[model samples]
Target chain A: MKKLINSPDSVIADALRGMAAAHPALSVDHDTRVISRAGGAAQGKVGLVSGGGSGHEPLHGGYVGPGMLDAAVPGEIYTSPVPDQILAATKAADGGAGVLHIVKNYTGDVLNFRMAAELAEDEDIRVSAVVMNDDTAVEDSTFTAGRRGTGATVVAEKIAGAAAAQGADLDAVTRLVTEVNDRSRSFGIALHAGTVPAAGTPGFELGPDEVELGVGIHGEPGRERGSMAPVRDLVAYALEAINADRPVGGDVLVLLNGQGGTPLIELYGAYAEAVDWLEGHGATVTRNLVGNYITSLDQAGFSITVTALDDELVRLWDAPVETPALRWGR
Target chain B: MKKLINSPDSVIADALRGMAAAHPALSVDHDTRVISRAGGAAQGKVGLVSGGGSGHEPLHGGYVGPGMLDAAVPGEIYTSPVPDQILAATKAADGGAGVLHIVKNYTGDVLNFRMAAELAEDEDIRVSAVVMNDDTAVEDSTFTAGRRGTGATVVAEKIAGAAAAQGADLDAVTRLVTEVNDRSRSFGIALHAGTVPAAGTPGFELGPDEVELGVGIHGEPGRERGSMAPVRDLVAYALEAINADRPVGGDVLVLLNGQGGTPLIELYGAYAEAVDWLEGHGATVTRNLVGNYITSLDQAGFSITVTALDDELVRLWDAPVETPALRWGR
Candidate 1:
């Protein structure tokens, strides 16, 4: 693999060290593999924590900050963090207001976060959990028993973070996050598979003229392998799937996310095409984010996320968020 | 060859359209191929304008905002923008305090921006220019006459933009950017070649376990090709080259930028290694940017940019600036 890494075993730790060094706003726990805000959790504010695998960066770790996540526990690449790690993060993030755990739909992540929440409660730390299953690509995948969580995880975290910053209780934060997941859907297409550092080879290979539509973030096989087509056609296919899953209409927030290896120009181009298509079908895109937000470790593809935005959701999203990955109005 | 583009001919236009849609804060003129902050340049403020080839995204277009460039002109991928586009941008961004043209050292870019300035002078608009030649990689390459401008362009624009926002006149802004360029040096390494949409092929090729150290942003031949080494070895080599060109000590601002395809996790890992090496050598890295700021399409590599920072530059950089690609204080 032509990746800039020292050893596969040290990728997460090395990255954590670098993240801590680069962002003074974040404090990394080398022992627990947890990244928390520099000042720890805010007192009397709803504490938020999230984590999954390591490859999809700027996700859990990048989301830790004042207005977003209080702590992020990262595991090995494409693997879930252990329950102990999650428990440690939860405890570290628990302030007087209570803590909220943002867990993805992966079986391992869900189970571990569940155990972590229970463990935190055993220590008398109030904890609530919101499980995200927003990927419409597949109902089940290699590591997931339900729909895989993808782009909407960012949307959920941002809105929930804003709500928490507003001094919302854990239950309110939980409800808002769950509502975001229910109102959102995402679909991805990969032009090439990403090579895992440890594997030293592409997770999968594609024919020169083929792409995997509805590809999972972990490089899992997608809906089908189809011949290469124009970007417009590919965009239409993904949007159609997303629209079908959740009839995209009214004011919606769109995320035209690159799956790592794609260039920003292409993602913007895709965003333009998506906007044109969505407006043509009568949906008004109220707000949008275009870049590599939730990526698949250099997989050359893109994903589209559509979230039907309510007035409160729009207000919360527009509210100040100060995270490494998503920052604005701060 | 695998890219998410409608056609090689329409890449720039499509991307521009998407940029306009995604960032309503900036206005894009399809006819002039320039992206300016919405509502045009701030009246009475010294206008800052920059542009070049389109491939290095979030550079010119993404940097247009209140505290950054007043306007950006983008040409075709890896091709310098025409004098007409530059002239249009210059005219539009000409505030009463005059406009500062931030041109890279590429032959086409310099020539075009010069001609554009002359054309603007014909319209009785005051203009000053700063040509950045900060790349320590090569003195001359396929597309340039002197050192190619690389990551330092971001630093120059950011500081100059801050100066402009503070009501600095054209001359002051020009001096700040020029000094920033002189103080910064950058070196890049490419593990794999980036494919240009128009070419339908990789610009260059590398063996399975090889990398081109000191590679130019446009895939120009670097210092040498060698077998892939550990990330520490790679980091050491890059830092050694940078320190040789400009002995990096004292307080410095470092940017560990991805060459497009490299993931953030790896970049952070590289950042950690760089910090260890720099601190070990008695240099204090006061501020840093670790992400894909300046990119060469989806090239699989990274570049390190270190700017010996002063109190003034730090204060200016810390000032509020809002742009699509780089935003912090604001």
Candidate 2:
């Protein structure tokens, strides 16, 4: 893979160093791979912590700041962080109120975050956890028992972060996060697979005229492979899958997430189709995001995430957020 | 090419539709292909208008907002906007004060923008233009008379847009934009060429182990093609070339821009090396942006831009900007 990296083994560490150099508002703990706000956790507020593999950048790490995550612990590329790393992140995020762990539903990640929560509780800190499984791609995947978590993690982090910033208690923040995940669904399609730096090759291959429907972030097998079609057709297929799982209607927040290598122009084009599809099906988009928020290395693909929104959820989403990846109203 | 577009012919139009759907704060004119703030130009405030080819997104179109451009005109992919479209944008952005056009150094863009400015003057709208040619890779290139304007356009827009928002006259905004271009220098390296949708093939080719150094945004030939090196070495080479053209020292604003296809993690990793190289060469980074701001559709590469900054420029750089792509502050 012709990646702009020093080496595969040092990718996460090197990126963390760069993050430290780039965002002085953030404090990076190199030894523990934890990224937190420069002034530490907010006192008397529920701290939010989320993390996973390193490839999905601007996710967990980029979400750390006021009105968002208190800390992020990135693991190796496509690998879950160790229990020790997660524990360190939990400790760093702990405030007087309590801490909330926003864990994506990968088996490794779920287990590690659970272990870290236990470890934190043993040290006299209160902790609550919410596991996100928003992807409607498949029932099981290579590294996941349930639906693989994808774009909803970003939505969850945002709304929950807003709640925490408003001084919501741990239980209230946990309920809000769980509600966000429950009301959300995602589907992804890949035009090309991303190559891992260590592997130096794409995890899988597709025919020149074929595309993977409902692909996972880690290049796992989707529901099926199909011939290349127009963006409208692709978007319709994704929306159909999501609607089949959960009927999408009413005011919604939409995320048209690019899988790293897709250009912003194309993502915008795809999002237009999504808006049309939603409106045709009785759903009105109230808030939308169109860009690469959760990415998988250099994979050329896109995912559509729809979250049925309430007035409270909409208010929280519009609240000020000051993070590297998602920031506004500050 | 495997792009998420309806068709090669309708890429720009479809993307514009999506942009309109995504950002309600911005108004898009389908007939003229001009994007402007929804509420129209600010009265008595210097209006900022920038435009060019379409592929480098979030450059012109995404920068339309309260603190940025009053209007943007996007042409067909990799093709300059016509005089009519630019003129429409100029008219839409015109206020009582004046209007400023920020043009990149491409031949077609310069010619088209110049024609539009004359047309606007005929209609009694004061118009001033600043041409950006900050690339230090070559003195002359295929589509450019002198250096190719690359990453410096973003810096110019932010600073000039701030000046305009602060009610600077057309002359002052034009002068500040010119000063930014003069103090800035940029260099790019590409691992792979981006495939234009119409062409259905990469603009250029490279050996598996080789990279194109100082490559232009349009896949034009750069300074040289060399074997791939570590991130530090590559960053050092870019910094040395920039330093050779103009000695980089003192307070500076840096942009480590990815060429669409590179991952954010890799961009951050590359940014660390850029910070190190700048500091080692006696330049201190007062501000930095590390992501895909200006891109060449799915090209796997990066460009580094350094702009020498004074206190006023630094303050302007920190000013609030709320664009679709680059946003911060209130």
TM-scores of chain B alone in all candidate structures, in the order given = 0.98, 0.99
**lDDT, residue A175, candidate 1:** 95
The clash count of every prediction, one per candidate, is 0, 0
Residue pairs clashing, model 1: none
Task: Assess the local accuracy of residue B178 in candidate 1 as a C-alpha lDDT between 0 and 100.
Answer: 85
Q: Model 2, residue B224: what's the lDDT?
A: 95
Q: After superposition, how far is residue A36 of candidate 2 from its true place, in Å?
A: 0.6
Q: Report the error of model 1 at residue B94, Å.
A: 0.5
Cα lDDT of model 2 by residue, A1-330, tens digit:
799999988888889999999899899999999999999877898988999998988888998998899999998999999989988988888888899999988999999999999999999989999999999999999989988888999999999999998888999999999999999999999999999999999978998999999999999989999989999999999999999999999999999999999999999999999999999999999999999999999999999999999999999999999888888994
Cα lDDT tens digits, model 2, B1-330, are 788988999899899999999999999999999999999888899989998998898788999997788999998888899999999999999888989999999999999999998999999999999999999999899989998888999999999889988878888999999999999999999999999999999999999999999999889999999899888888889999999999999999999999999999999999999988889889999899999999999999999999999999988888999988878984
Q: What is model 2's DockQ versus the real complex?
A: 0.87
The local lDDT score (0 to 100) that residue B234 gets in candidate 2 is 89
Sort candidate 1 into its docking category.
Answer: high
Candidate 1 ranges beyond 4 A from true positions? none
- What TM-score would every model get versus the actual structure? 0.99, 0.99
Report the C-alpha lDDT of model 1 over B1-330, residue by residue, as the tens digit. 788999999999999999999999888999999899888778899988899988888788999997788999988988899998999998889777888898888999999999999999899889899888888877888888989899999999999989888888888888899899999999999999888898988999899999998998889998889789989899989998889999989999999999899999999999999999999887999999998898889998999999999999999999888889887774
What lDDT, from 0 to 1, does candidate 1 have?
Answer: 0.90
